[model samples]
Target: MDLGPGRRAVPPRFVLPDVSEKNREGKRTARERLVVEREKQKAAERRRRALIVGASVVCVLALAAVVGVLAANSGKDKKSASDGPAVAPSGATGKDGLAIPVGKDTAKSSLTVWEDFRCPACKIFETTYRPTLHELVGAGKLKIDYHLVTIIDDGRGGSGSRQAANAAACAQDAGKFTAYHDVLYDNQPDETVDSFADDSKLIELAGKVDGLDTPAFRKCVKDGTHNSWVVKSNAAFDSGGFKGTPTVLFGGKNLAADPTMTPAKLKQMVEAANKG
Candidate 1:
């Protein structure tokens, strides 16, 4: 239909949306978000790994510091061990300075027992033969001379063996050497760990013995007043031509090398020696 020029029909322009362009823009946005999230995760992992590494380094440093401190203390103890003056317990002591008598000097038979406080075999022998020794000594049939050695300390480095021997000497001064000595064997620490290196443990053992927990005993042990005596005792042990500890001698004859020397056999030996 024809219309006048002013009333002519106009054609409308339809603008279709660009769907592919919109899809491309959405994909680009998604890819950018994924990249940002991935970067965040990587940063978090880096921080976690850094923290773990830092903690490990700190632990290693602490362990090294502890080891260093322990080494320094061990050296200090060794150096101070021989620095001070030593005291001896009063008794009919030995000329070699190692023998501590447990029975009368005028007894009919003499039995000498050599022991290292750290020696496991010595502990067994002491435990097995204690009853026999007590009976013989009490009956005036035999006397005992205890020689303490520090072979364990010399062969394997630790203050425990020497410290224990020194404490035994202190106990001797308090007249409770035998009691303290037995207790020490009864509660002997493992051979590797240096539990006896602490003087407090010796004082604790002294407390087990009657009248041995006195201030004098404590001071003697803490000051290592018998350390030099322990040194001399070790020298005597070297001079005795003994190969190992638990050396038992009856009437100046060694009984340890005899396979037949049981506790019962030891008692018989003491009786026979007394008769002789």
Candidate 2:
């Protein structure tokens, strides 16, 4: 050390430790790696969210499709039901399976009727003479046979006559033949509207009859179980050498031969036939 009176003492130089380039580069690389990892994680999170959204959309569409299919099937079932016929009354018997017999089979005098359900004239005849026939039959004077014909169907554009006859046969099976027969006349649709072709309407009419409309009855009607029988009956009617409907026969004699025959005259004819 030198004396310090006229000269400043020399100070020692202090040096800091130098950082290595490789170490700095390594720190920078580490920070960059962290940033890149964060970006990759963000990208992965976005992709995951998108996939979740897509899957949810697919599920919703699938649910909608299922609902649509169910609705379509339901509508188809109803439409199917609306496109058929009525059931025949149970245990209804006839000659050659053509005519459904009414009243006492053992009665002395017999009356046979050939009719079409959709015939307006037939409807009038039914409305007028049904009660009278019932009265005679109740008195053990006559038995009746009903032959269902479909001439009206052949002429009319729809299956009204056939369907109505078929349904009447079904009612015959259900023991409500008379009731349904009257109902058909009462609800006849202007002879031009073939509403009876709609089996749903026929079933609705069956509901009006007591102990007539039932599940089995509906099934029978819808299935057209007696359609073939009705066909056979109509064929028989044709083979019987008859052209028009509402053909009335008493003891194999044509009673409706007179075009202007009144209901009272009709009763009188039956009474005369019974006495003979």
Candidate 3:
């Protein structure tokens, strides 16, 4: 370009770069990179939290399952303890070793007498025919197999029947069963009164019979050694479908049920069976 006349020619000035604008752009880029890095960090933290919560739920469920199993096993153990094994007494005979024999095995006439110590009617029958039965037993004309039962305890609400029966079995163990048996009937408590449920009471009753209140007998009664055997005998009675206590059967006849049956008639039947 030509300058005006009388004016000195001047060179054109160059524009300098704007350093403030470049600094602002650099700052904006840095801010964008920082934002991206923060988003990545947040995503990683969320994944970690989810993993922790899932693991906690699994642990809790496993703990509950273990607790449930242990509780079930504990309940089963308690049940097993209460309902233990059925153990028969020493020298028990008959089906399931239930009968307690009072007479000799060689006797030809055998009498099946299902009796309960707590039964009022049984006490009556015992008192009425005890002498004749004893006479026949002493003469070796008849044998009596006493099946001790707990029907009273089953029907009524008391453990007297079972407890007394267990005591009688203890007497059998001590070889004083006949003496103890008579004593039990002679001093039997009322059906409503469960005095015989006490082991001390049963032991005291054993004092009436000689050599029946020994330590072994007392231990047998207290420890309930024949409790399982008594239970088994009662179960047999139930399955036998017999009527009730004092079910005296001789020669296929329920002698106790016979309206005209007497002690004389029993003796006659036994003598006849023995002769035959």
Candidate 4:
């Protein structure tokens, strides 16, 4: 056991720590955490994209629903007589036998209405809602020029419109056009066969309305002198872009349909038109 001072016994052999299992486990845990974080980020991105797409789809559907609803409710209410432009009852027609109003003509308003005499809605417009517009006309707030279209061909084998036109023309000649106009609407038949074609019946109807020279009106109707005017009116109706009876022109604006054709809506449109 005696050793030199500078010499030292040989050191014992050192052994390395066995850490392979622990390192492997730690590596596995780190890899799993990384995978989990990546999965979470991917899921979040997918949810965000889905939300944006869903919102866009909902907006499109909402707009479509609104349009559909408006279309569905378009024809619900009939326009009242109080919702039209004005015209005076002055300025009578010729004294032959045609009826016309002779009054002081008013200033021109921006609204014009085109109508067919045989149209049911036109009759309703005259009888029910015309007074309001008449008052405006009388007050110089509205101007209504009646462009009479004959659509009787659609219903009465083409003769009804012709007869009515003849009668109207006669009324125009006698300066009783408006009076005769009212009479025709009052005596409108069921629009069926053999109803509006009878000449005798038309003569009888002529006899009922006052202010029309019976003899002249009868002769005018028999002679067909007023037929051309009716034909012209029908032709002009096409120029005005009318596709059917009861088509109305408001401030020169055309419409296939208006969901808001009532008095209130009409008033609004008129106001807007005036401003423009």
Candidate 5:
């Protein structure tokens, strides 16, 4: 190009690069990295959820298995307790062989006592009248027919009464019923505590009686041999329509209901009956 009249030639100018386009490219790269990070976080969260669900399912299955096993054991125990014929104790007598005689059969007067081992009142009655009862029984003037019942077990929700009564029946089998019976009343626990529910505890108590804690006795107790018998006895008690335990009856009279009755009076009554 020619300039007019002494115009100098224009020099070429250098062009700068577009800075905004470079910034836009950098922004696109940052966005891509952010999207990748978000996808990775979502994938990790899904895996974590799946692991939690799997662990929960395993725990539920384990719990169900444990419950099933427990239910099966419980059913077996029930069947064992109620399925077979009730075997009466050795030398047990009375209707359905329910009574355990504590005195001679030839006694002139009979005292029928429905008792529960876990009964507090029965314990009191035994404690109060034991000496007189022993004297009369020794003299052969009066006989006692003990009808064991599980009234406490029925009412208070425990197996102590039934277990103890079964143990007493086991003692009867060993021909040590009278002595072991006395021992039980002597060391009876509180009615509220079902310590006697444990067969081991019952066996321990049997150790107090001489020659009572034999292998046979332990086996009888551990196996619950007379549990069915005890259940039948309790059923008999329910049918009798008599009141609570210590239902002592002499000559068709409820002696325990006689508020004025005493040990001496009981002796006199037995003597009178003998004379009659």
Candidate 6:
């Protein structure tokens, strides 16, 4: 049998290629590739965000550590009143946290001390000579009161004055004003970034002194209830012509803001009051 030159016998049941199906497969593949790319992009974004957050946390922690170290190292060595007597807290709480002994309101030679908690000099005064003053107060010869101030060096986050005052207030409510007062001075922080505004430090400090309930102290600090007292004290300080801390007023007479106001000077002043 003759056949066309280009014709050949075709086999039965041969597989036919489906163009539309191939196109569908190609489209599916493209869709799957697009989905994978989107997933990769999302994962990359998440990783970037995590990295940024981690870096920020590291930086904050590093800064805080440095500040704490500097503060720890900057404090001047304090000399205690070795020859003077020790005093006890009267355990009195006034309208604010101002604690005064309850008795006949006799006019003793009083000293109104102006202090800023962030003031290093104030720390020295509080640490070195406060015990002597305490002795005098307990002995009914002298009365010492605090005038709080919060003047920041550059308006950075300086919570030294406020924290100290508020903690004192909390301690006052807990009947531990003097003890808490000493602790603040003892744990003075240096002038650095992340200074004294740290809530953790305040909490740690509160835990150290007895009679101050931690939860109550934290709430008081967060609410800033004692800020008004600090404000009033600052106003009083301004009225008294004070520019810095440790400005003592002996019998209402202004004393210098010297860091070197020794125990001898304090005793001499008290004795002079006794003579008069």
Best by TM-score, which number? Answer: 5
Task: Candidate 4: give its CA RMSD in angstroms.
Answer: 36.6
Off by over 4 Å in 3: 1-82
Candidate order (TM-score): 5, 3, 1, 2, 6, 4
Q: Return the clash pairs for model 6, or none.
A: none
TM-score of each: 0.69, 0.65, 0.70, 0.54, 0.72, 0.57
The alpha-carbon lDDT assigned to residue 174 of candidate 6 equals 69
Q: Name the candidate, 2 or 3, with the larger lDDT value.
A: 3
What root-mean-square deviation over C-alphas does model 1 reach? Answer: 34.3
Clashing pairs in 5: none
lDDT of each: 0.70, 0.67, 0.73, 0.52, 0.76, 0.54
Tens digit of per-residue lDDT, candidate 2, span 30-108: 3464355345435644565666777788878799888988777874543233224423345555666567888887677
Cα lDDT of model 2 overall? 0.67
Q: Candidate 1: where are CA atoms >4 Å away?
A: 1-79, 83-86
Say which candidate scores most in lDDT.
Answer: 5
Order by lDDT, highest first: 5, 3, 1, 2, 6, 4
lDDT of 5 at 155: 51
Task: Give lDDT tens digits, candidate 3, residues 1-23.
Answer: 11111111111111111247657
Question: Root-mean-square deviation of each candidate, in angstroms?
Answer: 34.3, 42.4, 43.0, 36.6, 37.1, 33.6
Q: Candidate 5, TM-score vs. the true structure? A: 0.72
Worst 10 residues of 6 by lDDT: 6-15
